[model samples]
Target: MRAVRLSVVTAAATAAALAAVTGCTEKSDASGGDDRVVKVTATDSKCEVSKTKFPAGHIQIDVENKGSKVTEVYLLFPDDRIVTERENIGPGTKQKVTAEVKEGDYRIACKPGMKGKGIRQDVTATGSGKVAKRDPRLDAAVASYREYAQEQADETLPKAKVFAQAVKDGDIEAAKKAYADSRIGWERTEPVAESFGDIDPKVDLREDGLEEGQDLEKDWTGWHRLERSLWQDKKLTDRDSELADQLITDLTDWQKRVGKAEITPTSMANGAKELLDEVATGKVTGEEERYSHTDLVDFKANVEGAEKSYELLKPVASENDAALTKELDTQFAALNTLLDKYREDKTSYVFTSYDKVGKADRKELSDAVNALAEPLSKLAAAVVK
Candidate 1:
């Protein structure tokens, strides 16, 4: 539960370094002329819309939250893939989202309180519109993120191997350090890792998912399980190293799959939003890394991944809306400053002693993360526009 001091020098240097690395332009918020705007009214538990059918193309939904609680609306594919989503729309505030859809059945989800399953309505697009031309800028952006995803996966394998070896050699101190180092690359490419069947769960599943009747002895597997052994129990046995071996094996396969993985502009944006959500929901609460208390590592990695996603799409997004790009860049720098406060070394942040950390310090980080999430959530629709 050690706390690392935030030096004024580090903060100034990080801000100065990243400011030059990412560039942005200035622009205004403009609506597309081709958008078929639909009016959507969201209540506490229901979503009412003007129509459920449209021609296949880009359609805009002007959503007004008239409920007591905050609400979010999502356009989802039949396979449950989210097309586009808007979050943190407070009561009485109107938010607009434009989704590029094809001829198919989809679900319109309006989530009240911004959690759990929302009320759903089936929406269909029948007639085919003229094929929209692909933007070369967005295509290049997708290619960039795809390459980054591969780089992250490749970076993870050797670290996993080192972690496994440390555990096998029964060096608890070395294993503890290796454990945090191992998670960085995984956290960066977590969304893509999730696409590789059950490998993600098998490699990174937390102990909280233990079945109704199962205990740690039964279902607890992957990184957290090993974490509990090393930090809580303060021991690494032969059985623990066996789990580490399996982790390396799984990641090796994931690396190959990531190389062939299909990454589009939509996926990149969704991945960025999801990464921030990971911090807000799990890491901020200290539920993730419950044993090691190294949630900062995951938080920093999530921000890194999200920023990389924005960087990939910046080319096209900046072309259409530079204001949003500039806002995101500023927010990212702010969040990075907040995270760098706990720098343990060149590549790691010391674990936050959750029990020892003050409420004000915790809230400061949480507020900074939410601030960044506000701009990140709009990245997809912004780029697509």
Candidate 2:
């Protein structure tokens, strides 16, 4: 695990899956050439967004982290609905995000160290905004994605229970087998799971990701903690058994709350990119499932999630930007094909452990993820166009 990690999430808005959000079309002043581009300067303690008041359409957030620690920038609706966000902006690096917005009041938040409620700024999208003429296919994509999210949430609770029961029974080998199996749905729909803000940290947080003020012995709990007790410590504690029940309880909450999540087409496209980002930052590096070395399982799930998002929006994207769609198709196929090489168990969702992967193979996997992510980044722009 990296000592300094900035790649985490805090929800902006509701606690569920896909949002059919309200957005503005073209309501900003045409005379203000390029003024819609928001330049965000981030520091360890402060975040500044240039031209907080701008016209709304396809707005671009250009972020440069000048802080000593890694930070993140967000564009949020007044209700805390996430319009779009770019996380893991390491100190001294820059990242850009393009999102669709309606003319409305929004908040610009910067979280330095990726911790707590961030510095906030009020921004307004000025105009008598009209509903942008969006493709019907995009709307259809949103609907289909919502169904998919619900399906994952529905399937997860049962699998998680089996894993939890095994743990409670002190069935080490069964628990280990059921462990990675239980997380496939979660890793597949993580962006939706993360929309609830605190849920991800509660269920999936690794020890290395504990809050600065949290005590490891007391504050840290999740799949990773359980994995440590099972595989690393090689013994189960009473606390670990209790944690197993809590895991199911938390996921049960997630299952019931899935439909409550907000969904938008741009959010889906951006979520696809975020899934790839998770792979690059965590799973690809083998930090996510360190104790169990089941990183490949999560890695494949992340890729599948990203691919699902891309596939849903492909029809609209093909019409608006066929070239991008083609490249995405190629890259996605290549990545999946590459990942298939590691599947030793055809009967189940098992793969070679991440720890068993070599440096060259890992680099190859990283390259494949980046290759797909590049085209995936342009998806929101294409669909919104």
Per candidate, the number of residue pairs that clash is 0, 14
Q: What TM-score does each of the candidates earn?
A: 0.73, 0.87
What range of 10 consecutive residues in model 1 has the weakest lDDT sum? 13-22
lDDT of 2: 0.75
CA deviation > 4 Å runs, candidate 1 = 1-54, 59-98, 105-124, 168-170, 191-198, 209-220, 236-242, 345-356
Among residues 3 or more apart in sequence or in different chains, the pairs in candidate 1 whose N, CA or C atoms overlap within 3 Å are none
Candidate 2 TM-score versus the reference: 0.87
lDDT of 2 by residue, 227-344 (tens): 9998999888789899998898878877766676666777777777777876876678888788999988887887777788888888888998899899999999999889889998
Q: Highest TM-score, which number?
A: 2
Residues 151-208 of candidate 1: C-alpha lDDT, one tens digit per residue:
8888888988888898889988998989888888878776444344445656676765
Every candidate's CA RMSD: 9.4, 4.3
Location of the lowest summed lDDT over 10 successive residues in candidate 2:
16-25
